[model samples]
Target: MSEAPSASPHTPLPAAVPPLTAPSVPPHASSALLASLAPLLHEWLPRQRWFAGKGRPVDRFTLVSATELMPLTGSPGLLHLLVRAHQPQTAPPSGSRGAPPPADCYQLLLGVRRSLPTSLASSLIGQVQDGPLSGHSVYEAMEDPRLATLLLERLRVPGPLGSLRFEKEPKADVQTGLAPRVLGLEQSNSSLVYGDTFILKIFRRLHPGANPDLELPLALAQEGCARVPEPVAWFEGANPDDPYEPYTLGLLQPFLREAQDGWQLALRHLADGRDFTDEAHALGRATAEVHTALAAALPTLSLGRPQTELLADQMTDRLDTAVQAVPALLPYAPGLRRAFDALRRLSSAGPAVSAQRVHGDLHLGQALRNGDGEWSVIDFEGEPAKSITERRRPQPVVRDVAGMLRSFDYAARTNQPWNPEWAQRCRAAYCEGYAAVSGTDPRTMPELLRAYETDKAVYEVLYEARHRPDWLAVPMAAVQRLATT
Candidate 1:
């Protein structure tokens, strides 16, 4: 693995734009081929769960690169293409009626192809269309499973194309060909765990900027930050204009083989009727250590009122959308408004805290409790749907702390089947931990916590409404609690 980039706080930053290339073939491929493949892509993509935009049309298709797997037994001259598709940008038609404009961008589609297998015709037929393709599909040859095996083998092989550079050599023996298990945790990206020892995250959305998860953790690991997975190799290319642009398409990292996630651990403690004070205190100290290390390694950037104002505006917009999506939430709009107003007031308080770089998305799921009972964080990728520009911006550290706190609340509520008193105990433990390391007076900390928590709750309301309507109650309940307290 290559040495991680230097940790100097003042290093010049790279531009966020991704390299672009013109289509080799005409932008639109023949409808015959696309129609044949659309249904396969659509069905397969949604099933994979790693596909970011489930149920949405894959608007554009570009085959950036392909590597063929072995031939099928019964079929001659047939090959499988491990194809990558580029998402296109388009606008909704102007002056359209109540119908919202069409999606502005195409979705990234991964294509798998082979001669049609005989027995699976029913599963594969009729998914194709006439004009533009309606969905994405995969064509597999029946005579041989070699193509599928080969694809899996290639993913497991740590060749130059798949290998990532790590700051420290792995303590565990690094072996290839672990059975790949697709994790069901993510929405926008596909994550495959290899042999329960390493994780390979393939991004579905193509963006030009360095993935913060790929870059930030690597930087922190290089600086001896032990609270996150150690940096490993990232899959990137040198050519910016090639169909395969120079971006972190995938990342390879060590997996916490025996560790439970922090959220689960907290819930476990709560279930056992154990006080979370110690764990909370440890978390606080660990978080403080991470912040201190981050401050040392990266330059502190200015965060002005404009940024806060923008955040407030985003919260407002999300609330409006949420109310429209779930009219049930309408009755709670007054409480939601109060929360938004509080956020705006805090924003207008005028730069009480300096903006420094922060974990774009910090929550319990992003952390793991290792076998040794230590906590390690992962996934620095910001909100997956946001633009790279937004993900890369500097923000207050309290935002991250707020995320962690919200996660504790989520763990408690979601795991109620296991522990009834989980939420209250976990919150107490986490707050105690945060207070110890933050060194802020209790009075001021409450203000910061309230502001951050309210901000996070508003985001949660929208996120849950769109993706997990069942969980919308989690954020709504938090809003009610916040308003009362």
Candidate 2:
């Protein structure tokens, strides 16, 4: 992966603050509390959808930082934490066992109370066994209105609080004390909508640099792009050691309260025996506009022969690894190889292809439609499986087109009577709309499109096999079609 992506002026970097994880926040007390919560977290962390260490036992935990946002003696108290979970590596590099396994740091906002509330029973993380919070009940803070509102207050007034820094846009008007409620749909993160005016997404997994979810949107907002919701405010950790790096822990944006989830909308259209050509075409246009803004705001590069060869190598490598994971992909190996290999053959004859910041991991689910039928892309957080460095790397816009194309196929096959023709129409219309906006037809670069599409199917094969064995056939069908076609 390339070196970590830096934030542009649009993303105003917070000044370095003294490290709050140590020499402050009472390290000994926090450590003792963490030790007592270890077993409870070990039981709770793996069960969370946002927990990355799924299927692996959490060997132990180390409290990276802890701050009492509100004293536990209050009616509702808040504890902000950056905790690292150490889990056994499935396949550590040779000789790595001598050292402890790599740990993933997670941002946890916990609500503590003396007595358990019946209403918040679902958010419970169990009672503490020892330390200052020994008998206090702790639960997810995002679900509690008092704690969630307090979070917004932290964002409204921008400044350093210990190592944490809260920031808002140049003239952002952050309304205070809106009743807060967490959205239940998010998988990798938790979000709370305050009075239908603002939504704050609390990142579960902590990263050391600016997350694209906030990075790209902030840039787009500065560029006056309405196709995506503008990020209003966010909070992060400011470490003197990593002075320039902003460890983003959350994002705050205007809540699109009336907007419908793009995936659910598509499914509804399909169930009604309708095609999504019009919606898909509009969505393609929206995606193109976003790409245009990103390219202008961020850096863009041309993929010449060397980069093209590297792209082919990565696709081929993934295919090879995936084939091992799911033998079903073995038969289509040669066909998939042909798709990637053609990239090398095309690289020699054509002018260099354009590569720019793109919506990594784009799919129907990441889009939202307002009541006016306008499309707005959300969640620029790229692929969760990839490192932030890799996710922010520039890539061909066709990667996004391929993702949406694959999503259309998924919608078709999932329906009882597989509607291949409907998916085809939507795919074609989408490409046409994209061309209308960007004046570049993705189909012009046939090999690149096929390679990305083929790579996506290979990924799906492994994902479905591992997570949803019965649904494995859906992606396998795409693999066969993409391979033989």
Residue 124 deviation, candidate 2, in Å?
1.6
- Could you tell me the lDDT of residue 277 within candidate 1? 59
Q: Model 1 over residues 1-485: C-alpha lDDT tens digits?
A: 22232222222222321112211223344334444565456456445444555545565544443222332122221232223433333443355456542232222322222333443343343333433333322343221233222333333333433112112234434454355455666766766666677776766665655778877777787789988786555554333254344556667788777988776776676677666656666776677667767777777866456766676677667777667766766776676666567656776775545666678788877777766667777788888777767887777677887887788778667755634355556566666666677674223556556767876887788778888889987888787777577
The residue ranges of model 2 lying beyond 4 angstroms of the native Cα positions read 1-24, 92-101, 239-241
Candidate number of the best lDDT:
2
Q: Compute the lDDT of residue 408 as modeled in candidate 2.
A: 91
Per-residue lDDT tens digits for candidate 2, residues 109-168, read 888887766667788999888877888888988776656767777788787776677788
Best by TM-score: 2
Name the 10 consecutive residues with the lowest summed lDDT in model 1: 16-25
